[model samples]
Target: MIIEKGYDLRESLGVLWKNKNAAAIATGLVATLFSTMGPGLIVMNAAKSGGLTDAQAISWLLGIYLIGGLSTMFMSLRYRIPVVTAFSIPGAVMLAKILPNFAFSEAIGAYIVVAVVTLVLTLTGVMKKLVERIPVPVMLGMVGGVLLSFATSMFTAAINMPQIYGVMIAAFFLSMAFKGFSKKVPPIVVAIIIGIAALGFFNLITPIPLSLEIAKPVLALPTFSLRAILDISIPLFFLVIGVQNIQAVGVLMAAGYKVPINAMYVVPAIGTFINSLFGAHPAVTAGPSTAICASPAAGEKKEFRFIAAFSEGVFWVTFALLAKIIVDSVKMVPKEFTAVLAGLAMFEVFRSAFEGAFAGKFRMGALVAFFIAVTNLSILNIGAPLWAIFLGLLTSFIVERADFRADKIENSEAIEAAK
Candidate 1:
């Protein structure tokens, strides 16, 4: 039995390494790794900014990935969709904004409360109702809004680090050209390698002062309090559900697959509940990252995504096991490489959201949604996504109602003429 199990494991690795779908598979994994690492690092920094110690930050990182990723696996299985759920990056942004004043314990309390409320929303079906009411255009706008900052950052980085940026751009163009000949090597991987090499030659990378120490997660027990929930949970909830999930819906639908909103709600809730128990913040599906993975050109065969989830799960475990090496490697890589690489990887995400928000018979509604998300205004601490959908739906309803009335009048006239 042991030998058979080992053989199966080896076979799985062999299949992945020697995949016929190597280009697509590699693209998805490369993009996922790059995109997730940037945001994951940001979350760690945000935790630190919130006064969490290095150990706490590590715990938060490990816990978030484990809980969020495993739950996403089950969600993909249940929905038969290629959804890669994650903790809310915007929620982490909010934490960056709110943590200076509040205690980390309170932030955690709020996370738990939000998770509970989210679960309640799922059970009561209110969340599903709200999701259904949202129009596609508005959802696209919300997605665009979330990714706009990240995309803009790439250009900003190019200006800041011209040499590294040039290497990354060259890598992108070369990858695009080589793709016509061989579809195995991913552009993002090529970009990372080129960028690192360029930076190393320029003496930008300082040899990391290596200290060999194993970091272990220190688990904290949950202390749920109403005050903590009210202050922290509500804002975090609004950030994840409103901004994050809205974009997530847009990506799924834009790709010609409509996930049941209830499934969407429940998956994150499951992720969050597990995260809450393990002392991590709430989790949400990563629309931009998953969109990066689901590109048709990247060989996004349905099987590839399941393989991605399986691989990502393994990646997380391996990363955990070799935390020292992983951390060291991350530190060794220049930040400029990561920035441009991430933006390039998500180019498809930007294009899809743009098309979804502006194209088809839904142009007017989509335009309104786009404007609202770009404006980045908040109403009563609620983000722009809520309002974008609200306006899009209102406009769509009004136009549809007018069309209905006009059709009735036309039918009446036809009947009179026939009589």
Candidate 2:
């Protein structure tokens, strides 16, 4: 296994102090706000699907942010890179679909299984090889299939609460249309701020607990089920490896940051294992937040970017401590409103996944996978996403072997160039 050694807290702290600037701190704050505004609502939406009580959901929230925050700081300081990470948004969306079909304990079991599998890969020092072997188009096809509903849900949600959804949607697009404003304020924040005001004006906001409620997060035991392992764990594993960690690596690399890839896999695996015990999903080197933190908007000085990650981690820990407040806040809003926000939050990811799935080689296989996954089919307890991958690859092997050969040649040359 490739281990990143020589982490000195004192030196990293010194670097943070030396590089502290308004832009870096603001960038980190924006990343944190983006996560809480939309993805946080999505997390709540997914938990509700599993029928979790308030306390259980609070525990889930606390675990995810706490572990995720601490790990982000650790990895950034240890490697001097902007390592912004958290629980997988797409994985959580997929979980929302599968949770309705399985017990919560079984889902937790699947989470643990995924963490364990990734850890094993990390330890064996074959994580990169394993990830590289998966056909990118096929993997992305399955991802697009599972995530289609979350992005499309916004339209259906608007049908029910047109006023609130309309305001958010309008705000979202207006913010996206302008680049200067988007650098400071993310589109989701604009949408959410305006949407909340509209909600109050229309009296869509319900009367719920809005008082200080410190979270008393509790842990639960996991129950393993073969059905959930196949249906949930396998698909989630592919997402963490294929989508989250790998995507984060590519984003950072493009930003001119040479991160320790094995450490990236290993650290998130550790966080995933711990958080699953607290009823949270897999932790990952997150793509969206990493992109934000690594952007030039963070600061002109690339060396100081890790401080942005530090700022995000501190905010996450604070949010983790106030998980109950967040849950209570979500309760005050209508379910459809939150659903729309979550759906909108995932729109960018959905677009990327769709393009990656169908805009290249293995088109026929990806098409098959995409259609199969959209059905959310289940056979002998295994979910369609996993089957989508299998059948997608099989289709390619039979009728599109040339695509695989091309991919292999490209991968080999890339590996050689890296070496």
Candidate 3:
């Protein structure tokens, strides 16, 4: 399919309207909720623990969601790919842990350093070259390992809340079975409806009082500290690039898109720099949320699937604008419900990654990576995903080298005999 050159709002809206279906809307809503509500709450809580005032916390949240929305929108339109951007969850967790020790300005300074480093890596093409060198099996294995826990949690969560989750799971499979009968309704939509109905029937969902409040953005001038740079900036940079970006590229590739690595890094790096000025964490390509937008259920046609991501961006902006109301509403839903939904949504992605990782000659290497990733092991403060890929590649080289040499020698012997 030919991609349009420039971003046009009218064209985007038209695609959204034309291709809009239950699946697309469901994907957008789920992705938006997952990206903003939970992560936003975590960041706010963390900031509060770190001695940030209510106003400061609100500024961080608003900057994150607002910039994330705008960046995702721009990238999706520019590339005609479902590229969703959001704050790094791991980064936020790390910030929460370390922010209590440093001044907020110091944290902001560290964020700036991370953004500058990311931008430099992208512009120098170092990141792109590194990504290219990573074998596909290792990449997919790492992604599959990362997602394994989430996918398996569907069953454990269902067992804990048998009635609601059981119905939801049944509805998911039933919807999948019945999808041929209805083009407009997908399994995810059906499952959402079933889950909601189950929640209401069981009186599990509470009604949240709605209030509208605009978030005020606050700018905190950064103060650089060697300590903050070492403790926060460097790790944050590696987490975003190594773990988040790797999964982002893995998901998109699993969904059959060849996204430019430089474009991937450049857009979010700039967004992170801008948002950091307002006291938000660095934005990176969202992994789990982007999977929803890239899923086949998001749209029937691959060419127009980006509309789902665009719709998600719209929801993100709307949520940021109505932060108070959206957060309250999201809190009304049970956590288990959201987990099941996320797991179900990601099941296909996990399946694809698993298949891709182990499909060919590097099966053992892929398996090694997959298990290591599933362990979620971290060494030297770096995320397990990166190590999984590195170790997996090393194993593949060691195991497959002999076979390669034997094949070369056999080919040489055959050539000599023919001569």
Candidate 4:
């Protein structure tokens, strides 16, 4: 099914209105919750390490969320699919490491360079076609590998803080035990409520005064540096497209969505340009968030899944506009709670990832990719996801020659038949 059709303001708004439901909204809320949790913290830590002032850090958050939120909403509505996007977490980690070595101005220049490169690929449609050719099994393996950490972190947090996670986990399972209850309440929402009640009952809550702090975003200027280009731009570019973008693409395709691949690349390239101006990393299609929106849990009607993405965009935009208030509010919830929610939310996607990875062909290659991703191996600051795809493809090429030959023969026959 294609998400493409003529844009109609009245019809578009009506579609969203008609699809509004508890499951889709809860999916979006969980996705947004994950974003504001660890991902948000990492942004702050990266800014501190980069020596950015409070105002600059706020601007970074603003740029990250606003561009990300707007892009997500636009793509979901425009394409009529759950086209979710977010800042690259690996990009943030890379920047944290590289920032101290080079000036932030130089880093901004690198961001511009990478965004341009992404845009160039988008305009030519090279990346989308190339990405489409990748075998689904290997790609799924890489996706599973990339996401394994997020899933495992929940259990880790639960081990450390059983008081909170135990209650939440019990609630989640209880919700799932009753199909009728889960359909109405959403298992995730139930978990959140129980988690909160547990926190309050144990007197672990630290209440803060409700107040809105204006996040005044400041403009930043860029200056080119050859060293920064070599050190940052090349790797950053790969992370944004090769790693971050790949995960989103893989997850959606695995879920049987006819992704608007070209548009996905193009929109994020534009978002990268916008995000770079205010010190945030590039916005690429998001894996976890997209998975949440695209999964069967979003709603019974697959067509309405895009509403989850749109809702996520709404949350992200609100978070961006009210950065200080939302950030503070997010902080009120325990990190363990967020971690468990994220981890639990991803179980369906993770299961699908593994199923696709090992079911039919290229199992060896896919397994290798999954291993690399789960290990978090990095080479020259390049994250494991890229390496996983590379090594996985290589292993398939060398070890599974017959599979490729059969695929090639099938394609050739189809082409000849068409002719």
Evaluated with TM-score, which candidate comes out highest? 2
Pairs of residues at least 3 apart in sequence or in different chains that clash in candidate 1: 24-298, 85-285, 86-284
Computed on alpha carbons, the lDDT of every model, listed in order, comes to 0.61, 0.85, 0.73, 0.75
Regions of model 1 farther than 4 Å from truth: 1-52, 72-83, 89-106, 173-183, 211-215, 218-264, 277-279, 286-308, 320-342, 360-419
- RMSD in order of candidates: 8.8, 1.6, 7.9, 5.6
Between candidates 1 and 3, the TM-score winner: 1
How far off is residue 348 in model 1, in Å?
Answer: 3.7
TM-score, predicted candidate 4 vs. hidden true structure: 0.70
- For model 1, residues 1-419, the per-residue Cα lDDT tens digits are 10011124455445556654655546546545654545655565466558776667667776777765576555544444456777776566546545665666666667767777887877786775544333445456655665676678788888887788876877777787876532445566676678878887888886878775654565656666655554457646765676577666666666655455666667687778667655578888677656655556545465545445444544554444444444455566666555576567656657876886676544676677667766766666555655666676576666645533453465345334422
True-structure lDDT of candidate 2: 0.85
Q: lDDT per residue, candidate 3, 1-419, as tens digits? A: 12224558667666667766776767777677556534665575467559887667777877788888888888777777888988777567556556777889988998899888888878876775555443556656766776676567678989888889988988888776765532345566677778888899989898878767887778889999887776667657766786677678778877777565677787788888888877888999988778878988787877777877877888888877666554455467786776677667655556667776777656788888889877865566555665776788789889876534553454345334422
- Model 1 CA lDDT for position 145: 64
Off by over 4 Å in 4: 1-61, 76-114, 136-153, 183-186, 218-260, 286-312, 330-342, 345-349, 374-385, 403-419
Model 2 alpha-carbon miss at residue 417, Å: 4.4
Per-residue lDDT over 242-296 for candidate 4, one digit per residue giving the tens place of the 0 to 100 score = 5567778767766766666667777787888888788777788888788878987
Encode model 2's per-residue lDDT on 2-22: one tens digit a residue: 566746978998889887998
Clashes of each: 3, 0, 0, 0
| Superposition-based RMSD of candidate 4 using all C-alpha atoms, in angstroms | 5.6
Please give the lDDT score for candidate 3: 0.73
RMSD of 2: 1.6
Predicted structure with the largest lDDT when compared to the true one: 2
